[model samples]
Structures are given as structure tokens and as C-alpha cells.
Target: MAKITYIEFTGEEHVLDLEIGTSIMQGAVDNSVQGITADCGGACSCATCHVYVEPEWLNKLGDKSEMEEILLEEVCQPQANSRLSCQLKVSADLDGMIVRLPESQF
Candidate 1:
């Protein structure tokens, strides 16, 4: 399992143990973690699951897909490091990934 540390804009942090090969959105949803709405399930259609990859961990995550890149623009506060959690598949190399939640999910 990969350990994902999620931090909110307010600096609140929560760690979740995600099964390998599962998407970040699924990990959050399965654990009922707050801040990840995942309105579109794991299809990468909705930006509600948006999160900002911490600078140190950005290079460790998967590259953004064309679909995810398009949807990120609609997220609350898109940043260069922004990604849809649904697009981030957990892996052994990403064990200590840290993602920051936006202030809003709309």
C-alpha cells in the first residue's frame, strides 16, 4: 500500500493507506476522506477530485493525461502541479505522496 498524505488549504493533514494500483480518488472515497468529492467516479471527467501535488513529489506522480489536463482548468484553483486524483494511480514508488486539497471543490 502507498501512504498518501493529503493536506488541505488550511494546512490540515490526513494520511490514507491506498492499495497499490488503485487511483487516488478511489483511495479517498474508500476511506471516506474529506475534500475529495470524486463526482465523476474515476473517469477523470469531473474536476471535483482536484489536488495539488506537493513540489517534492510532483516528479514521482504520473504525467498528466490529455483528458486530465483539460479538466483541471475547471477546478477551484488550478496550479501547474494540479492533478485530478482520479488520474493518479497509486504505486510503490509513490508511497509517500503528498497532495494538497484546494479550498473549494466546485
Candidate 2:
């Protein structure tokens, strides 16, 4: 399992030990973390699970897919580090990874 930290816009933090292969979005939704809405689940069809991966961890994640890139373009506060949580799968390499939620998902 990988330990991931999700920080809300308000500075609230939720740290979870997610099993390998689980998406970051799944960890938040399953644990009732407040920032990620995940309206479309892990389908990558919605931007509700948008997050900003901490700069130090950016190189550890995979490149965003075409669908993810398009969806991110429509989310609030898109940044160079912006990512769709559902597009990120957990793994040993991601242990201690930190992601910051946007002020709004809509």
C-alpha cells in the first residue's frame, strides 16, 4: 500500500494508506475525504476529482491522457501540476505523495 496525503483548499489534510492499483480518487471517496466529489466515479469523464499533485511528486505520476487533459482544461484553477485523481493509480512509488485540492471542483 501507498500512503497518500490529500490537502483541501482550506488546508485540511486527509492521509490514507491506499492499496496498490487504487486510484487517488477512490481513496478519497471511500474515506469520505471532503474535497473530491468524484461525480463520475473513476471514469475520467468528469473533473470533480481534479487535484494539484505536489511539485516534488509530479515526476512520479504518469502523463495525463488526452481525455484527462481535456477534462482538466475545464476544471477550476488548472495548474501546471493539475491532474485528475482518477487517472493516478497507487503504487509503492507513490508513498507519501501529496496532492492539493482546488478551491472548487465545479
Candidate 3:
């Protein structure tokens, strides 16, 4: 398992223990984290799962796919480090990553 932290726009934080193959969106939904809506269920079609990845952990998450890139453009207040949580797969290499939600999501 990996430890992932999800911080909401209101400063609420939820730390989750995620299975290695799970998507970050799934982790949030499974743990009841409020910010990630995951409306498309990790299909890479919806942007509701947007999260701003901490700068230091950006490289560890790997590159986004073409579909994810296109969908990200539709999210509100997307940033340089913004990502779709459903697109991020948990693994040993990302043991302690941190992500923040945008206000629009809440």
C-alpha cells in the first residue's frame, strides 16, 4: 500500500492507504474524500477528478495520456501541476504523494 494525502480547498485533509494498483480517484472515493467527484469512474472522459499534485511529487506520477490531457483543459482553475486523480495509478514509487483540490471541485 501507499500513503496519499488529499487536501481540500477548505483545508481539510484526508490521508489514505491505497492499494498498489488502485487509481487515486478510487482511493478518494473509497475513503470518502469529498473533493474528487470521479463522475466518469476513471474512464478518462470526465474532469471531475481533478487534483493539484504537489510539485515535488509531479515527476513520480508519470505523464498524462492524450485523453487525460484533453480532459484536463475542461477543469476549472487547472494549474501546472493539475492532474485527474483517476489517471494516477498508485504504486510503490509513489508512496507519499500529496494532492490538493481546487475550490471549484468542492
Candidate 4:
């Protein structure tokens, strides 16, 4: 399992131990983390699960898919680190990953 940290825009942090292969969105939703709404579940159709991967860990995460890249453009406060949590799968390589939520999902 990977231990991931989710930081809300307000600065609150939720840390969780997520099983391998689970999407980051699923881990947040299952733990009731305050930031991710996951409006489309893990389907990648919604940008509600938008998050900013910490710069230090960005390279560890593979490049975003075309669909993820397109949806990210529509998220609030898109940035160089912006990504859809639904597109990130948990794994040993991602342990200690930290992601910051946008001020708003809309």
C-alpha cells in the first residue's frame, strides 16, 4: 500500500494508506477526504477530482493521458502540476505522494 497525503486548499491535510492499484480518487472518497468530490467516480469524465501533485513527486507519476490532459484544462486553477486524481493509480512508487486540492473543483 502507498501512503498518500491529500491537502485541501484550506491547508488541512488527510493522509491515507491506499492499496495498490486503487485510484487516488477512490482512496480519497473512501476515506471521506474533504477536497475531492469525484463527481464521475473514477471515470475520468469529471474534473471534480482535480489536484496538484507536489513538484517533487511529479516526475514519479507518469505523464497524463490525453483525456486527463484535456479535462485538466477545464479545472479550477490549472497548473503545471495539475492532474486528475482518478488518473493516478496507487503503487509502491507513489508512497509518500502529496497532492494539493484546488480552491474549488468547478
Candidate 5:
């Protein structure tokens, strides 16, 4: 299992202990973490699961694919750390990952 932290724009934090191989979007939805709408259900079609990965944890996560990069461009208030939560798979190596939600998503 891996522990992930999801912090909202208003500073609300949802700390979750989730199984490996699950998407970050699933973790948030399973735990009822606010702001991760995940309208595409991990299909990578919608950008509603958008989040900003904490700078320190960026390297621990996987690199964005060509399609993810293109999808991210369509989200609101994109940032250098912005990513689609559904694209992030949980792994033992990603324990303690932290992500921030954009105001527009909440």
C-alpha cells in the first residue's frame, strides 16, 4: 500500500492509504476526497481529475504520456506540476505522494 495526500485549494487535506496498482483518481474517489471529479473514470478522456503534484514528489511519479500532455493543456489554470490524477498509478515507490487541487476543479 501507498499513502497519498490530496490537498485542496482551500487547504483541506485528504490523506489516504491505498493499494498499489490503483489510480490516484480511484483513491480519491474511494475516499471521497473533494475536487477530484474523475468524470472519465480513469479513461484519460476528461481533465476533471486534474491536480498539481508537489514538487518534491514529481520525480517519484511516472512521466506524462503524449496524450496526457495534450489533455493537460485543456485544463483550467494549468501549472508546471499539473497532471491528470487518473493517469497516476499508485506504487510502493510513490508512498507519501502529495498532490494539490486547483480552485477551478473544486
Candidate 6:
């Protein structure tokens, strides 16, 4: 299983021990961590699950798909590391990954 770590700006951290095959959004919603709305459910149609993935871990994840890239452009605060969590899947290499939640979603 790959473990993903989520860190809020407030310093709160949630460590999700997810099955290697599940989507990052699914893990967050299943774990009930705040900041992940996943309104579109893992379809990559909504930007509510926007997250800033630490640069160090970016290479670990594959390139962003066209659909996820376009949706990320609509996020309120798009950073160089901004990514739609729904598009990322849990993997053994993603253990200890830290993602920051955006300030606004709606």
C-alpha cells in the first residue's frame, strides 16, 4: 500500500494509508480529511480537489492528462505544483507525499 500525506496550511496533517490502486481523491474522501470536496467524484470534471503537490514528489507521478490540466487552470490559486488529486493514484512510491490544500474551492 502507498501512503499519502496531506498537510494543511494550518499545520494539521493527515496520513492516509491507502490501497495502492485507489485514486488520491478517494483516499481523502474515504478518510474524511477536510479540503477535498471531490464533487465530481474522481471524474476529473471538477477542480474542487485541487492540491499543491510538493515539487520533490512531482516526478514520482506521471504527467497530467489533458482533462486534468484544463480543469486545474480554473482553480482559484494555481501553483506550479497544483494538481487535481483525483488524477493521482496511490502507489508505493507515493508514500510520505505531502499535498497542500487550496484556500478556496467554490
Highest TM-score against the true fold, candidate: 2
Candidate 2 lDDT at 37 equals: 96
What's the lDDT for residue 28 in model 2?
Answer: 97
Tens-digit lDDT track of model 3 for 1-106: 9999999999999988999999999999999898888888889887999999999999887789999899888889989999999989999988989999999852
Query: Residue 25, candidate 2: how far off, in angstroms?
Result: 0.1
Sorting all predicted structures by TM-score, with the top scorer first, yields 2, 4, 3, 5, 6, 1
Candidate 6 residue-wise lDDT, 2-103, digit = tens? 778887767789987899979888998999888899999988898899999999999999899999889988999798999999999888899889898877
Candidate order by lDDT, decreasing, is 2, 4, 5, 3, 6, 1
Candidate 3 regions exceeding 4 Å error are: none
Shift of residue 26 alpha carbon in model 4, Å: 0.4
Q: What is the lDDT of residue 85 in candidate 2?
A: 96
Pairs of residues at least 3 apart in sequence or in different chains that clash in candidate 6: none
In model 2, the runs with Cα more than 4 Å from the true position are none
TM-score of each: 0.93, 0.98, 0.96, 0.97, 0.95, 0.95
TM-score of 6: 0.95
Each model's lDDT comes to 0.87, 0.95, 0.90, 0.93, 0.91, 0.88
Best by lDDT: 2
RMSD of 5: 1.2
TM-score of 3: 0.96
Tens digits of lDDT, candidate 4, 1-106: 9999999989999989999999999999999998899999889998999999999999888889999988988987899999999999998999999999989999
lDDT of 1 by residue, 13-106 (tens): 8898888999988888887778899988888788899998888888887688889888887877788898898988999999998998888999
**Candidate 3 residue-wise lDDT at 17:** 91
lDDT of 3 at 44: 89
In the range 15-68, model 2's lDDT, one tens digit per residue, is 899999999999999999988999998999989999999999999988889999
Which prediction has more favorable TM-score, 4 or 5?
Answer: 4
